[model samples]
Target chain A: MTAAKTNDPPPPPIKYDFLGALLSYLVPGLGQMTQGRFGKGILFFVSLYGLFFYGWLLGSKKNVYLPDYHSGETSIVSRLASDLYTRFQFVGQFPIGMAAWPAIYQYVVSVQGNEKPPLNGFMSSPSLEELNNLQRNGDKTWDLGWVYTVIAGVLNVLVIYDALAGAAFREVRATPGPLTPPNGGPSK
Target chain B: MTIYVHLPVLIVVVSLVYSATRYDSWNKILREALHWGVRMTSFLFMIGLVLYALSTFL
Candidate 1:
């Protein structure tokens, strides 16, 4: 009679890094690819890139270019200023300026050495100019950037949730220990 | 500028810089950076909404 043969137990589950998934949310697609989900990663990047492009276009049309410098007038160089300046006269200005210049001038200009954003909406002569800009392109037509920002914000939330879910999936499979009975029961 | 505007912009700048840095290893810092980015973006977006409301009414 031959002796009974023994076999090695199955390997434990693979664990995933939660931090990796969070990072993927920041970069969109990096985390998923790192976790070996190439298809998911590609999809993430596509969605992220698509919204980014749309946001950029909407922002550009609104004259809200992301400033290159944050310090001062010289500090705020813009990349699009070179290319789109002619097409959109205000291409390099921050998007907020569309709403800001008018309101600020109305409230703060009357006060001496005023530098603060207005606490309430104020109107002044220069506001007429800004309003004309708003109206020239049709009142409703130029307000689309707000819509873009809202949509992009929503998409980012979805991407973050997806990343978190992927991380949770990783956690479920991490350990490889045998399923020994908790009360020290005999192995099957 | 008002604190609301300044704070949101500062948050965004710090988050963006942190996210774009060169780091050799993955660490808790990266996770925190992402969290900060999400927070800052949310803050700015909220402020944007407030501005929208103010623009439309007051």
Candidate 2:
């Protein structure tokens, strides 16, 4: 008796979890953890947070900030120039959610001239004299700190992408060929 | 201390995070991370030596 030939079913399509991706954006490894990838999630959380805090400590919280264009300088050209030149590093730092808040708050307070913003370790604005001193001293530490913080922020973006996109390369299953019989018979 | 000391720490962290993202298995991740870390450190050392030589001669 001849064996009946049957076609194999197609593999299921890959499903992307948008909510998980969003959660990853909000908190670096939360999405992976939610998806039961506890080890990966924790690893991401620890590494990213460690780098961020270390950078912050190195920079003394001055590294992350939105550009401060002077008051009433609403010209689009000037804004673009400020962003491109003075605050470009912020483009990298903005990906870090909560850790970046102090800088954002400082920017808002500086622009709005809010009632003397309270002095805190993270948000304490350096006085003009201190700024001048930093400038005159040509402090390489400040530059290094800024670079470290920017790098940390940029690296978190990689973590977020990993959480959302799984491995860059995945192993795909080989499809069954017509020449190969399901019961292991050789092709005629 | 010179800022260059931070380079090794940065490389280690980057290698660990990068390897962790690529593999699900802890052992595989750690092995690959160490491999990458060594490779990066060696490459950086070579570049630093070349730069120092250039600076000294020029």
Candidate 3:
């Protein structure tokens, strides 16, 4: 009697790693490196961080910041909503991890009315007049700079996802049958 | 020219980063990056042409 072939059971869902995702979010490509994908991690590091920092440099260290709201309104939530609308570029930049946090710190300090003299303008928002002056100058480079930063952050999000979800396509598959050599030699 | 000075770097970075996410091997990554970079550059060029036309006429 012919024996039946037994099918293998499905593998468990250990592919999605939340810790790896968190590590990747903190440092672009780091989780993949830790997961033994050294080349991929390094590539992500160079690509995302390089783009973000280059954009920051092009902006003369003035981009990646959210301006504080002092609208004198009693509703904190409404004020936050309004400021978020105006400073939406930061939403794109925030995924870049610690490199973008100084802006948040500055915004929070200024919003809470504890903006100190020691704050040496590291990611701090410029005054309305100063911002208007810069805008009036029609410097297209500044606009492009922040755009690069946003793109870097957005792209890093994909890196984080890769760390969590693993590769998009399976790298291995079953070969149906052995073939002859390219030169038409017999199969071994 | 000043505005577009950063384009080449941006193009390379974006294409590489994007392609890296979809594949594991360096061979595939570099090849896909080239395809993505070319397509994006062409698309951007088309947009620039439109803008240039608008500027010239209006």
Among the numbered candidates, top lDDT falls to 3
Q: Is the docking of candidate 1 incorrect, acceptable, medium or high quality?
A: incorrect
Between candidates 2 and 3, the DockQ winner:
3
lDDT tens digits by residue: candidate 2, A12-97:
56567777777776777787899898888888778777776677666656666665554556785675467536668777776766
TM-score of each candidate?
0.34, 0.78, 0.83
Worst 10 residues of 1 chain A by lDDT: A67-76
DockQ of the candidate models in sequence: 0.03, 0.55, 0.84
Candidate 2 clash pair list: none
| Alpha-carbon lDDT of model 2 | 0.72
Error of 2 at A39 (Å): 1.1
Question: For every candidate, how close is chain A to the native chain A in TM-score?
Answer: 0.41, 0.72, 0.80
Q: For residues A81-174, what per-residue lDDT tens digits would candidate 3 score against the true structure?
A: 7777888998899898888988888877888787572269888887778777666776777778899999999998999999999877546544
Write model 1 residue lDDT over A89-169, tens digit each, in one string.
222122212222443253334333344434343322223466467658554433454344334434444445555553322
For candidate 2, the iRMS in Å is 1.8
In order, the Cα lDDT scores of the candidates are 0.45, 0.72, 0.85
- Count of clashes, each model: 7, 0, 0
Residue B35 in model 3: lDDT: 100
Which pairs of residues have clashing backbones in candidate 1?
A12-A176, A13-A173, A14-A173, A14-A174, A15-A174, A64-A95, A69-A75
